[model samples]
Target: MYYIHLEGVPMQCVLVWLWHIVRSLTSIEKILLRDRPQTLYDLSSKGTVPVLQLADGSVIDESVDIMKWALKRNDPEHWYKENFDHQDGLVNKNDEIFKKRLDRYKYHVRFPERSYQDHRADVSEILNEYNSLLEPGPYMFGKDICFTDIALMPFVRQCAHVDLEWFNSSFPELGAWLDRLKESELFISIMVKYPIWNESESGQYVTWE
Candidate 1:
């Protein structure tokens, strides 16, 4: 597990960590990306965090791909059941549309073309759609947590944290949904802090059994 820490919390890494907890995956080395280590470049020239290198030497780099891989191995919770096409569509919208607006909204200074409020409004459009979808209560697809919920939660959390007060007031359903996931045992367990991976020192090994 190669993960990036932002604002003292795992970003994309949350997806992999959540799946690890759900499936009880164990003995995985957790490498914290801090100063751009050479080992990271060696494994993946892309230098992106949340890179998973299996014992067989195969690498799973993308966060969504890693989630799918883990579910394929052991989905005791059956997170990847029917309605995969719908799930994939939602995930794609999150990764493609929501994520872009989130970055702009979160870092408005970098995106000068739009005012901070405008960027925030752009994000709200997507949030509004999700808020309606979640009106059935609890989760994206209703009742049980599914792959779509896990895939979108981290990004939604990021968006909410941008302006929490506004989020809480505006998207009541979505906000409550996010709060539930944040308070889950799985979310809290994966949030354990690890020392920055040092070239000379062994990285931390994470396991949940």
Candidate 2:
């Protein structure tokens, strides 16, 4: 069976959503960051959530890597259809640039040196890039949801949540795109809350089938 250890957080949510969209049936174990189980430690010493344990016993811990693995197995919608370099470029920007800014903006207290507004300003150019990309169609790659859209939507959603008023006014296209992703079956299915896993219990795991 395909086994996944996840939390309800955005990165984990991305993996869950991708697996669901690809119809990758999996045994999902909900985890708590504060109270990670020994199994998690054994599987991934880094203790990262959204770790996927393949039936062969190999594991993939990175969220994006897990997405690639799932999609590579079956991409019915052709999320990676065309423009390989462009898709990789956008995904890279989201992960490398926007995500850092988003983290600082969302939890300004942790990054006390930079004001929350400063963090928001740092990602303005990236947001503008997304706005430009979406001008031709709703999805990032135009007319179809692709790797970049699913890869970056959660981070964008997090950013929009930071200052709803500013986000709506400053980036209307992005705000609408975020809304569309939030309302999709892919988002909704993966977002269902599950009780945190406990090793002491018997048959306590959940399966996303």
Point to the candidate with the largest lDDT.
2
What lDDT, from 0 to 1, does candidate 2 have? 0.76
How many times do residue backbones clash in model 1? 1
Q: Which 10 consecutive residues of model 1 have the lowest summed lDDT? A: 1-10
Clashing pairs in 2: none
Score each candidate by Cα lDDT.
Answer: 0.75, 0.76
lDDT of 1 at 77: 72
lDDT of 1 at 155: 88
Regions more than 4 Å wrong, model 1: 1-34
Q: On residues 1-209, what C-alpha lDDT tens digit does candidate 2 reach at each position?
A: 67778776555335434454443455667888888899999999999787878879999888878887767776778887688899888887777877888878788899989886787788787888898888889988888888888888878877787778988899888888889988987777666676777777531344444
- Number of the top TM-score candidate: 2
